[model samples]
Target: MSKYWNEEIECMSREDMKKLQSERLVTQVKHVYENVPYYKKLMDEKGVTPDDINGIEDLHKLPFLTKADLREAYPYGLLAKPLSDCVRIQSTSGTTGKRVVAFYTQNDIDIWENCCARAIVAAGGTKDDVCQVCYGYGLFTGGPGLNGGSHKVGCLTLPMSSGNTERQIQFMMDLKSTILCCTPSYAAYIGESLKEMGYKPEDNKLKAGIFGAEPWTEEMRREIEKSLGIKAYDIYGLTETSGPGVSFECEEQTGMHINEDHFIAEIIDPKTGEVLPEGSKGELVFTSITKEAFPLLRYRTRDICVLTREKCSCGRTLVKMSKPMGRSDDMMIIRGVNVFPSQIETVLIEQGYSPNYLIEVDRVNNTDTLDISVEMNAEQFSDTIKDIQKKEAELVAAIKTMLGINPKVHLVSPKSIARSEGKAVRVIDKRKLH
Candidate 1:
């Protein structure tokens, strides 16, 4: 039998799940329309009202909320509860223009933690397991979200925030941590560090890892798993949607399952805003049906991927989202061809190159130039210049086949590329600078 934090909810029939979602969505729509003036104004302008949305079926009628809307609303415009009622707040990293702040009441926190607990349980975590959470803490949601979920699972929780890699490994070895939680890039770096420390995968006690907070390729996943000798599961969420527990990967490893009981998901054409049929690739949208302090109705997530109801071996009835193809904002147009960083990473890993690389896009004489600097494997370094050139040529050929664009591949020495303790900065688009 498959194990789950909430078996009934996870395995609920489609009919029952839809009914539950319908009821919660109606209540949530009414709550937002009544409490949030900013959303109320949006509804008024769109000629939509809470009564118009009787259930999830009417969700598309609601005005969609975008990052631009959140920025315009700023701190308090979208808040559905009073400050006194809210117990906590989490903000986005603000690497971009403005940081998005989301509030959570005690009840909201409870529901969010419950969603996270389902993720932990789905990743083979239990009260007996030691969960070491290393996704940054404080204003960022990743650390706190997973930390609370670990507690909910009754695991021996280690609230070790991100960074201090050497210490992260020490705790993992000393406590025999069974579940590792952090960004996929950090996990990859940790795997590299373990080898440097003369520790084999078997020397550590980690059985599974829940990695997220950034996009990672399946090739990168396999690399981390082989290095750490553990299955690396992907978790997905954003601060707007109440952190990292909105969805999680089950043992199937095919895709991440959305917590449909708490949130309703949809796919829409990014440009046309038309909802697509199942299995169609488009922008992933979400509606929080159970949040109290901050409720977002039909929020555009900008992640490009497909949703599938196809039978999964894990037996979770929740809809599964393919690993995101790319964020709409992150997809670049190079010489009239669309390119995603993930596409480049996929080619690199397939060519036996390290995931560490830099993509530089620039306009020269009105023509877009794509140049990638890839870190060479120390073991594969050839002494002869001709051999090195041959290696670069081979990579260029492989990338061309994958991306349909010719890129200049420059091979640098191993470990020359700076390692990222957080989300790796892989792209430097000089075209934007011009």
Candidate 2:
């Protein structure tokens, strides 16, 4: 059971990794400039030619691609390879105007699976393990990405898509699943379900879990680990960048390691678009160097995090990225204060409330209001009105201390809030600022 899937690439020196990225980036840029007219137009407007981008140092000269750009480009605008060359397409679960669709050739899928294999192996997966993939299949990238990776690792793979909790548990107990892959929220729900079924955390055979696809706090990770009796690892990715194996946590559990051979990562000031120095907290940007069907150059991920080349005990030389703090586009601005749902979640978990909570923001009479509905755990749920009000006030004060703004807190009964099988919807903003 080796700790790494590919030791040569994962442990490549910084100098050699940069050289590989430069070569791939140059060839990828030329391919996109020659084939993708929409990206070519953006590069032309920015006065950047393929020759202008010689290596990673010149990456800042390229135009940034945002979600809006993807929407504007629509179905075929950003396709670098021809339709015949593309073998599959995975879409973002965004419910907004246009869903982001990413295309992949067979080679692209192979590379993506290899990236995911690195994630699994880093999590202590082996050929003898049973990898249960509960992420949604078909269009969603989570299931397919981990599924292919499990196959590549020669694990006995179970393609159990999201939802159907009872069946999931039955399969887990029967087949003795060793590795579980899904979003963090869903993992929590599964842990709760197993406990309710009179099965202790030690009863299940699951040893490690890979959770991602939503923003979660460290508190939630500890809670899940306790409930499931497994070491929880975080995997980070987006559909545009070839899904959940872009980077992953190793045994060190410090931060996720980015696969620099396939993609180059950069952090930039969100407002000014200036690339930030290393260890600076800023928006994350990714450039797909090896992607064939859809090689996005300087794609603005909008995720707020910092990257560090700090050496890891896991022995991989890949750069480690802090778990995303929040999204620049999703951060709520109320009464001129920036609030992220993760901040509220931290308070909830610390206050002995369930991680499942809803933040509703609305504007009334030219004033913004913040209201939070938190789920009280079975032990915390109370029957008396005064007791509930007292708990709510305590949460209000705690959240005020954390966010610098008071919010009306309502504690609901246990399991009152809807649980999501996919990315959990934590915030609902009714203000029409657009």
Best by TM-score: 2
What would the TM-score be for candidate 2 when compared with the true structure?
A: 0.98
The whole-model lDDT of each prediction reads 0.92, 0.94
**Candidate 2 Cα lDDT to native:** 0.94
Task: Single out the weakest 10-residue window by summed lDDT for candidate 2.
Answer: 375-384
Mind giving the per-residue lDDT tens digits that candidate 1 earns over 220-264?
Answer: 999999999999999999999899989999999999999999999
**Local accuracy of candidate 2 as per-residue lDDT tens digits, 1-434:** 78899999999999999999999999999999999999999999989999998888888999999999999898889998889999999999875567999999999999999999999999999999999999999898999999999999999999999999999999999999999999999999999999999999999999999999888899999999999999999999999899999999998888999999999999999999999999999999999999999999999998999999998998999999999987765688999998999999999999988899999999999999999999877678667989888999999999999999989998877788999888888999999989
Q: Given candidate 2, what's the lDDT at residue 63?
A: 95
Candidate of highest lDDT: 2
Give the CA lDDT, 0 to 100, for residue 46 in model 2: 88
Model 2 stretches with alpha carbons more than 4 Å out: 382-384
